[model samples]
Target: MSARVTMKDIAAELGVSINTVHKALTGKAGVSESVRAKVNDKAEEMGYHRNTSASSLRRKDINLVFCLPCASREGAYFYRYLWEGCNRFEQEVIDQGISIERVEFVVGGYADALEHIDERLQVGEKIDGLLAYVPGDDRATHLLEQIAEAGVAIELVDGDRPHFDRLGASLADYSTAGSLMAEQAANLVHASGADARVLLLAGDPYTDSHYLTARAFHNYLRDHNVPWQVEDLTGAHAQVKQLERELKARLSSSEAPELICSVFAVGSELVADTLVSANKAGEVMVIGNDLFPESALALRRGIFTNIVYKDPVGLAYRGAKTLGDYLLWGKTPADPVQKGAVEMVFASNVDRYCKLAGI
Candidate 1:
């Protein structure tokens, strides 16, 4: 049999232990830079190319995969940021000369995501790393474990998973920032009236992180003893219109909600649109989520009083940079990349920071 040009072969050529090769390959905690350089030099001289296929037999790519359980742009209100971020990531990677693949896996239950993983493996599409904007759920956890076992480094971009740190990457804490927006909404209600009821519209379930804002809103209201009802309005435009009518009826009734907080773009825009058409725009205190085009319009028209905007372009730039760093240098992200918060947007800055994205 032809001798395989493996890490072991490189180690043997350098008269070093196999563990040394492992350290050299991973550039892990203890190895000196000089030693790493030497190993790399020797491996190169020995014509040792990393056999990704062979590596998959024992381990898999640690490069990266950006998985969006379900890439539902129209149906998912929060998908705007995810799509924008991933698109930015692709551009950034190409600019940086890194070999990383970003795939939007159809979002399904744990079983479905796992099935996708299996399909990728079957096709011999090796994944060394995965960046996901996943929901916080058991099924997500299981799929994460399976991906880890395959030796792919995983980062949850805008969500949290209990075992994400163990997966050798990191998670951006949207929940923390979401709480801030929620608190703002609470304050809006407080200013409006303590007896004022509220209606919170949530984004799609495509990623749990998107709903973090809603969860935070709920908590804030509960803490303040404010009465509120939450609804999820995700899907087609017709469905959104239907939800708007339902919300309108509730708002128009004698027991109408005084404050409407939208935690998703579609739903928020729907609420705003409904209010405008009903000529009840200024009657209700309105807050919208994610300053997409529609939300921006609503804000400009005075339909939405406040916006909890998330910077999709920033997320994309950072996610791509993180993936590139991991692939090129085997390094991890130093921060969430959004600075002081897991989420940042036009609403957070009085100077209109989102304009930097030119969107």
Candidate 2:
């Protein structure tokens, strides 16, 4: 029978003590290069299977673990930008000598890579740090606490909660972004000279730092004394059609809103398309959140004045880089890093910064 290789066996072969073998194998500081080299050579000669999992409890590997929510195969357009940014950033960091591996976790469903939280821990992995994009406060908070208690480094990207001490990027800066969008919409309204009212289209208040944007819109309308109304369309197309019909009837009876600020992508596309077909494209100012290609072309045709853009790719790239710095170098970031900055994109520069970053 083949013998099981252990630390004692390697130490005996090298004429060293088990303590020396332990420190050398674990990459712990204080072992001299001469002894570490001798012990490593001897262990490799024996075809030893070092218990890396056991060692990882005491020493972490330089790998990044990324956790995200579940999405369909088609996925969302925003996620695509995020994925591209993370891949590019990971490659760049790897070129700088950081070993990185990404692990994606779905919220409730598990496929091959991650079946459950336990599976996330079992995949031949030792994580030096974690990057989480969990969209829910309650769930992300619970998971982040677990990672921190384990001594694994953590960086929160687009999700916000006070449980984490570090942010890879930030999620709270949406209020400023919201305010910017409102101001742009208002500008478009004034450009139309109060000849048109403004219709604020919104969707899914729970997703993507949206509450801040919605609140900002309300504040802007109040402060400017602009006549506007906010509507929530949770993707019921039939209901949206009904609202559109009613809105159109109101336009016939009185005057139409000069601008439409679509706060979320799904409802924005629908609202924008409806208004365009009604021959109101040139008459109204349209602005919305999170640019997709369709919206990009819309801006080119002057269908939209501006887009309140959030760069997801920047979030992931910066998030991973920040976590890597903290875990490997033991460096801390600026305390209370303000929420991330949002950019306003218009017809002139919309094409350049539309892609977002992700896992």
Which has the greatest lDDT? 2
lDDT of 2 at 261: 74
Runs in model 2 lying further than 4 Å from the true structure: 1-60, 69-75, 96-99, 103-115, 122-125, 164-169, 224-227, 232-256, 276-280, 336-338, 354-359
Pairs of residues clashing in candidate 1: 61-128, 62-128, 63-128, 64-129, 65-129, 69-106, 69-107, 70-107, 135-208
* RMSD, every candidate, angstroms: 7.5, 9.9
Write down the worst ten-residue block by lDDT for model 2. 106-115
C-alpha lDDT of residue 278 in model 1: 86
lDDT of candidate 1 at residue 191, scale 0 to 100: 74
Structural RMSD, model 2: 9.9
Q: Least lDDT summed over 10 consecutive residues: which range in candidate 1? A: 163-172
lDDT of 2: 0.62
- Per-residue lDDT, model 2, residue 248, is 69
Clashes of each: 9, 10
Off by over 4 Å in 1: 1-64, 69-77, 95-97, 100-102, 105-114, 135-140, 164-178, 186-195, 202-207, 221-242, 334-354
